[model samples]
Target: MSNKKMSGFTIVELLVVLSVIALLLSIITPRYFGKIKEGQEVVLKQNLATIRHAIDQYYSDQGMYPTNLNSLKEKRYLRDIPEDPIMKNQEWQIIKAPNEVGVYDVKSRSNEISSNNNMYSEW
Candidate 1:
């Protein structure tokens, strides 16, 4: 018989390699999705904080809350109203000012639950 060994992987060896790759993917994919969702949540929180800060600044400067989100951009309090990451929209749940003439607090219009078991709006 010839002394040379096989030059490439056998069918069984190839199957083992494929199974290992699949196992690794199965383990990694869920964590990857979890990280993406976590990142979106973080972005949502930062956007909310920025918008709230802009609202406060507008209130302090104008002596009233903004009449609308657009007023903040028009008056340069914010370059733009930060879009809600979770809802994938710029539509914010505007809380009216106590004076009944302007925006107060804001909330997410999304109904999704957060990691803390609260609805995104409640956050």
Candidate 2:
């Protein structure tokens, strides 16, 4: 047999490729996660708006806010309680009206600060 060496990538070549891939991932991963966070924030805002609108509509029709979020759903004012995207849970921080008899407003259960540098609950 001839003494020619086999042609293949060396260990250095493999390491270089791996490092390039890692660098790309390091550069890309944070931006991707940031975008995901932004999307979730948008969804959270929309859900909050929808729920607030439902509460207002319920108040207009019934002359008072519902006893709970589920009451809105029960009365068909809302199809269902919207999930809090930031909190990643269905739980909402229910705000009571002046009389403390029914919901006056809602907020996210998450205490995490948003990209806007405000608490998610304050949103």
lDDT of 1 at 110: 93
Local lDDT at 115 for model 1: 82
**Which residue runs does candidate 1 get wrong by more than 4 Å?**
1-6
Clash list (residue pairs), candidate 2: none
lDDT of 2 by residue, 1-123 (tens): 689988999999999999999999999999999999999999999999999999999999999889999999999988888899887788999999996599999999888989999999998
Relative to the unseen true structure, what is the C-alpha lDDT of residue 106 in candidate 1, on a scale of 0 to 100? Answer: 91
RMSD of each: 1.6, 1.5
- Residues 6-123 of candidate 1 have per-residue lDDT tens digits of 6987899999999999999999999999898899899999998998999999888888888899999999999988989898999999889774799898999999998888999987
TM-score, cand. 2: 0.92
Query: Least accurate stretch of 10 residues (summed lDDT) in model 2?
Result: 80-89
C-alpha TM-scores of all predictions: 0.92, 0.92
Alpha-carbon lDDT of model 1:
0.91
For each candidate, what is the lDDT?
A: 0.91, 0.93
